[model samples]
Target chain A: MKKILNNPSDFVDESLRGIVLAHSDMLRSVGDPRVIVRSDAPVRGKVAIATGGGYGHLPVFLGYVGQGLADGACVGNVFSSPSADAMLTVTKSIDGGAGVLYLYGNYFGDKMNFDLAAEMARDEGIQVETVRVTDDVASAPAEQMSKRRGVAGVFFVYKIAGACAESGASLEEVKRLAEEVVINVRTMGIGFSPCTIPASGKPTFEIADNEVEIGIGIHGEPGISRQETAPAKELVSQLLAHLTADLDLVPGDEVSILVNGTGSTPLEELYVAYKEAHSWLSQKGIKIFKPFVGEYATSLEMAGFSISVLKLDETMKALLQAPVNTPFIKQL
Target chain B: MKKILNNPSDFVDESLRGIVLAHSDMLRSVGDPRVIVRSDAPVRGKVAIATGGGYGHLPVFLGYVGQGLADGACVGNVFSSPSADAMLTVTKSIDGGAGVLYLYGNYFGDKMNFDLAAEMARDEGIQVETVRVTDDVASAPAEQMSKRRGVAGVFFVYKIAGACAESGASLEEVKRLAEEVVINVRTMGIGFSPCTIPASGKPTFEIADNEVEIGIGIHGEPGISRQETAPAKELVSQLLAHLTADLDLVPGDEVSILVNGTGSTPLEELYVAYKEAHSWLSQKGIKIFKPFVGEYATSLEMAGFSISVLKLDETMKALLQAPVNTPFIKQL
Candidate 1:
């Protein structure tokens, strides 16, 4: 597999090293270089929000750190969770007197490490809370929503929580709002191609050129089934069927829509999908309040996309529209 | 070739349809659906800036149409220029009485069409001036710089022109400053893979899996040559060598850097390249201001990137730092 890299093993750190260098005005490394924090971290009395996961997903954990977003992020090796020690270091670096809130996707490795880090932080007398986002409808049955994997929908949680924390909300309020965001969000993806893990130098999975895996996870996990590639309209319709069913959205319900590219998918294609989504929702009489289309969360060079819908109340809608500035997602 | 589209011929129009629906808050179409303009266009007494070329490069022409960027964009088919009639309609929609400055990449087809559009707009009593960006260093020799093709460096032109227009600079001043930006900019790109033209259902060019094309154009034009794939560091070094020589950047000079990803290149990979560029420039004692590393301009799904350096004087630096808001590129 062809890629732009130095040492495959050093890919994550080198990328982070470059991130800190390229965005020194907004981000910096603290304690450990793997732990990136806002340049102006630990703002007095402001609740600190943090997220962490495996690397390779640009603009996810790290790119989302800035004013009105996460104050800190713990970066891990490609497709591997950060060590608890690394997470603890990041938590300590950004913990203001108020408390720290950890917002991360629901994954076994991440859960184990983040849990241990939370315990260590508690022992050190820093108040901490956690919200594990489980929004991927394809990963579990509707009745077992908590067992679902988190995908691009976690972006909504980050935006809502970051905005709530920036408003000087207490750690509990921010956590509660973030949890609510996770509960109301639903995401489902389809993959046209698999991505290569740097160390492995091979695609995580295989797909025929004219076939696609519907209901695919971000990590290139086996999807619902492999089928002949369909047009953008059909793909969007299929994904929407699962997402809308999971959310049980009623007519007149307002929501924020995110059509996120999985690494290699072009914005042009994402917009094509967005067009169908807009018409689909409108036909159902579902009111779309805000729409975002691009690569927000990704599996490195995966050729596909995920559609995420965050059902919005007045508070959620306001927070979604709130001004937040980050390297990847910025609103003013 | 697999793509997320319906009819191959409908790719551009369907994609534009999606863009208007997804970004309804910021952009809309007027007269011809292919002509996309800001929601608040024709602001009286303010110089309007419009740019367009082919449609495959999503964020290039359309993405830059917003606050502090181009006021309107005339979209065309994939890898092809918009018709002169479409450009004239877009020019008319955003004219605002002050004038309309058409800024776009230098390509034979685009030049012919945009030139014809400028004539049409002038006939209709609209003050129209055109600046075709010639910034891709590989496209022509230094002595024949006027014949160079425009690539990612047009982004610098848009920012400068948009900022100048937002400051209420007259059409002539905006054109002068925009031309100055073109003069100070240089860009070079290498491609790891060829992009497909939708209607053809085949890649526009071919390179062995283990080979790479250096000095490639956005539309898959033949590059300097194809050779064995090189690591990110070496590739950046090779590109920087050519760009620095062309710009004659001296020590202590200030420059804004853009490590732009061609569509499918991952941001993580881009950062890896940016890391090398940062160190390389710092070694030369160049003061980098406003380093941007992402997909600002792209070929539909090309897997590569171009590095752009804009030697910044005080005015250029200030304008580059000015606030701009759009669906793709937003800075505050």
Candidate 2:
């Protein structure tokens, strides 16, 4: 593989060390190096927020640990679940007197690990709540929504939950808010290429030169279809059609938009996709709130992007607009 | 090409339009859509800062325009220079009474286009100055410093100049400080893959599966050499060695570090690089300040990243720390 890595097996540990060193002001290592906590974590009387999954998706689990966002994160190897012990370590470190909330994308390994951690935390006398983000409409049919995978839309849940927790919300309130964010969100992705896992020293999947996979998952999971590549406008329309219809969005509905690049897609290409989404939403009489266009939730070096639409209320808007200062994201 | 684009020839325009539409709160189009300006531009007495180049690099020209950064930017087609007319339009719109500073990476096409724009602006009775960023140590030998190409190190110049201008520095002071930043900064890049320009619909360059090129320019210009891919630690060491030697960095020196991904490179990879850089600098007894790791400047979807070091002083540190809020970056 043409990846810049040290010992393939040590990729996650070394990268975690690098993250702590570079963002010393905002993050620090907890009991385990895989568990990262805010430098000033355990905010008294505040609901502590945490997330984890894999390491390839940077700025997802770790980058969100800062003011007005997640307080701790359990890091795993690239596309692998973090050890439950690592999650418990982070949970113990970040939990204040109030409680702790575990939020992450809906995936089998993540669900099992984080759930195990939650149970362990409870046994340790820490109040724990769990909410999984399931926003990828193409991951499952409408009847099997619970089986859908979470992708870029997870960022919306993190923002809302982090803001709610920062506001001194109770564990129940934070959990409910996170779930609400997940309920109103819909996401879909298109893949132009596959990313290699450093450890495996090969691509997770193979993609053709003249084709694209619509609604692909971050880890190279099959999407709805693989067809000849379409223009940005058509792709955006198709993705949005699936999402808007799935969400039952209607005229005059207001929503926030996020055009998140999987990895290798440039911001320019994302903006092109957003341009078309904006026009489509406008035509539907739907008001677009703070439209975000960038690489938010990414697959390591994957070439493509995802679109997430969150039907927003005044409270959701306020929560998302709250100030945040983190290594990957900053808003003021 | 497997890119999400429509009418390859219209890529830049559509992308720029998308940017403006999504970032309406922070950016707006001037006379020409190719020219994007701060929504609150021409800050009466603040020295206007502007940069322009090909459109592929996001958060470089347009993304940095905001309260304490650039005031406007002239955008061009992918990997191509903005027209003289576009630059003139942006320059006129952002010129506060204090004058305008044209700062951008030193490239033949950008220099000629911006120079022409400066002349036109002067004809219209607006004071303007140009500071070419030449920080890439790999592009040229020490004796041919002027021939060096600017890479990711241009970010240091932008942060310093923007802060200086925000502090109400006089036109000469801003220009002088900007040039000072240029003098102290050094950058080098390693490319694992080439980025395809939309207009061409083909890769700018080609590389073998297991080879990497060091000291590559953002536009896929040739680098020092193509060698078998090395470990992240080794690559970081080689890159830092070139930059530190060129900067004449000593044991007692303090510097700011930027580990920037050139697009396609994941944050995990960047942090891994930073981990090595931190250890190397610490062993040298060099103090690191405000170390940044992420995709700050990119070359579309090119893989690999760049390392930049700016030997810093108290003034430069303070300037870099000043508060700035924009769509892409926010600091407080």
Candidate 3:
């Protein structure tokens, strides 16, 4: 296998061991080894944010469990959703006095698992709310907006909601803020290569040497279209077009941009992509409030990048600029 | 080309433009566009630290320019050293009233360019010092330690030295601390895949699909041997053996470890590597002070990971715990 590891089955557990060993100061595992929470989780008066997802896409689900971010995360095997049992364990561990909000991608499996867990938590007399992020513009049409699958734009949702929760917001208020972010953020990604699942030892998808998939999913699901590989400038322009159209963005609008790299793409390449996106937005008279260029979500060793834009309001702008501290990312 | 870029020849300049666009608050281009300094340079009475090298390695040369890190960095073409003129430009822009230290990797071209820059800056009447980090144990025999090249271990050199400089330490004290870190740190890496330079559009090296290169340099240079890829446990064991022996680390000694991905490798894999390293060290009775697992240094999108251990004394441990804020890395 091209990937590095011990036994394929031990992939997730070994990586968790590494995380526990490296960031013991900020994270801890609970009833289930898969359920990880902040060391100081369950802050007395603050609403808690719990996120869960499959493995492989790091910093997405596990990396977000820290200060100023998600309070807890339950991870499953590579590209597989965690069990409802694990989700319930995390809910019980991170519920502060205020309440707990389940924030995650709009995937069928995750939705099912988290929903089941939330019901169980409610039975336990713990208040719980749910807000699924549907930010990937290509996942669905505008009419079926809720059908959209979340992608890199979940970063903005996490940041805005984390900030609100950290400020001692009520569960209702935090859920509202998170939903608002989900409605405003749109993402479009292009895939040049696919990643292998350690357990399966098989590539998620395939592409010709001269082809690229536009609007590709993180799991390598078929995108909107496949075309000949093109320069970053053209691809970014098309991605922005889809994103701006999806958000109904217009001139004089201010927004924040995140040009994220799928795994295996060099950081320099991501900057190259950002340079093009910045120029495109500038030429259109769109004011960029804050520009983030890095890898927030990845598909193992897949290659390519995504451009996400959040049409920001005054409230969103303040939340976006606030400090964020996590083992995988920090803005201070 | 398997890269997200515009004109390959514009690789460096475009990336620099993107960097300036994204991190304007933390960094700025000096006289030469390639020479970048902190937004607030020359911190009155504090010693200034200037580091520089080629492009492609994000966060290494330029990513370290901010609070609790280097004050300025002059970047060059991909994997190529910055010109003497560019280095001098950075030195002039970031020279605080106290002095400036020229800290960088021990590469032939870089050594020559920075040495010449230091001379020119001295002639201009600004006090200057130099410290070359030679921490890669695989680059040379123990007896020829000074000939070894600097690799990911440079992160420790920057951290401890930057903390010292940030504390208003004198230029002499800062240089001493930097040299001390360079002496105590040792790194070893294994390369699984080669990277392609954008300008050339050619892979740096070639290896059999099933083969791995042990002791590979950051630039894809040949290592001690090429053999069939094995489990993470075996590779990490061999790497730690070289590092602990070269650093003369013994039982009961405290150390900080950085399991660095050489681009392309997934963060999960790096953590898996860290888990093995932690177990190996703990079983040997060695105590771990801090652990960083990520892409601190890279070679474009090369696939590999390096283990860097910095033997820690009380002073070094405290320094390592200090806060660090930069465009790419934050330790707060």
Candidate 4:
């Protein structure tokens, strides 16, 4: 496979260094711990927000670190969770007088490592709270909401919780808000083709030319089913059906919708999906307050789309509309 | 030729509709105008900011509309400028009580349409000012800065000027700051493979398997030259050499850098380019602040990257650091 690099193994480190160099005024790297934090971090009396996940998903872990999002982010190898040691290091760096909150996805490796890191931080006298985002309804049975996998809906939790943390909310309040967001959110995805893993220099999965996968996870995990190609409107129907069934979304329910394009799905197709989705939601009498389309989060080069719905209330709406500045998400 | 689209003609319109539907709380469409404006527009006496460009560069034109960035955006067809009528409608809808400012890249079609719209706005008793972002050093001779094409550097102009507008700067002040940013910024790009336009179902340009095109423009415009594949460091050196020489950048100068990936470049490769770029800039004693590496602005599925540098001053630095809440850019 053709790539622009000196060595594949050096990809993540070099990229992190470049991010630091680019945003030196706003971010810094801890040498021993391999954590990326805001240059003016450890805001005294403010609850610290920390998130870590695999590399590859730019602006998610790294780009989301700034004034109103994450205070620090521990990055792991591509699609792999950071080690407990790494998370602990980041936790220590951003821990001020106020406690630190660990907010991340519900991926198994991340759960394992972050759990260990939280314990380590507790031993070090730093109060820590954990909020796992399990917004992907496709990943688990409707009866077990906690078993759902996390997808891009984690961004909403980060935004709301991060805004609360920046507003000097206590760790308890921030954690409560984050958990509330997780419970009210649901996502479902479809994949058209597989992406290439840089290290392997091969496609992550085999997808035939005339087929698409429904209910695929972001990390290239096996999808729920493979089906023949269909029109954009039909695809939207299938995705929305899965998400609405899982959430049991009723008429007149207010929601914040996000139609995310997995890397290779052009804005053209994404918009087509969005058109149908908006109509469907409207037909159901659902009021979508804040709808985010385009690629807020993505799996590299995967041609597909995902739909996420966050049930919104007045408090959540205000928080969602709060002004924030991060490398990736900014809402004024 | 693989795509998830049902019809080609409906692509741009459908996408715009989706954006409006998704972000209805934040944005609304002007009746049949091909413009998307913030919901709480005509903000009393605030100066309105408007920008326009072709579609396909998701989050560039549409994503930058919100509270503190752009008041409205006029979208064109894929890689094509919006009609003059569209621009005029956008200008009218976003013209706050104070006035309206026109900001856009220096593409021929966009310039023509915006210029016409500015005249129309003036005739309608609206005070209008214009700033054309010309930062692609590859598009013109070093002695003719005004002749350079506008590429990703337009984003910097959007940022600094947007902050100024948010702070209640006069139209003249906003235009002045935007012009200064344009004058100080420079960008150079390279494409390894051509992007396939969805409607055409063909590559925008031809590149041999082992070939790369240097000095590529954002719209698949022909590059300065095509050359054999080179290492990341060498490729970066060649692009930077051209940009810095054109700008006459001196040592000890500080600049905000962006290593932007065209749609299809893997993060791994982007980091490789960023590594060499950071080292080169540092070796020149240039202080890099807020280095951004990602698909901030893109060119469909083109396998390429662009480097944008904005020479910074205290004002520019503050503006860069200012909080922005747009779909694509969120700098706190």
Q: For each candidate, what's the DockQ?
A: 0.74, 0.79, 0.76, 0.49
**Residue A177 displacement (Å), model 2:** 1.4
**lDDT by residue for model 2 over B255-292, one digit each (tens)?**
99999999999889889999999999999989998898
Mark the regions of model 3 whose C-alpha exceeds 4 Å error after superposition. none
The positional error of residue B303 in candidate 4, measured at the CA in angstroms, is 3.0
Scored by lDDT, the top model is 3
Q: Write the per-residue lDDT of candidate 1 for residues B1-332, one digit (tens) a residue.
A: 66778888888888999999878888999868789999999888899998898888878989999989999998778888999999898989999999999999989898999899999999999999989899899988999988999999999999989999999999999999999999999999999987888898888788898988889999988878778988889999999989998999999999998999998899999999999999899999998998888998899899999999999999998999889989888574
C-alpha RMSD by candidate, in order: 1.0, 1.1, 0.9, 3.4
- DockQ order, best first, reads 2, 3, 1, 4
User: For model 4, which pairs clash?
Assistant: A22-B290, A22-B291, A23-B290, A23-B291, A291-B22, A330-B325
lDDT of each residue in B202-223, candidate 4, tens digit only: 8888878888888988877877
List of clashing residue pairs for candidate 2: none
Q: Isolated chain A: TM-score per model?
A: 0.98, 0.98, 0.99, 0.96
Fraction of the reference Cα-Cα interface contacts (below 8 Å) that each candidate reproduces: 0.70, 0.82, 0.70, 0.62
TM-score, candidate 3, is 0.99
Q: lDDT for model 3, please.
A: 0.91
Which ranges of candidate 1 are over 4 A from the true structure? none
User: Candidate 2 versus the native: TM-score?
Assistant: 0.98
Model 2 chain A: which ten-residue window has the lowest total lDDT? A323-332
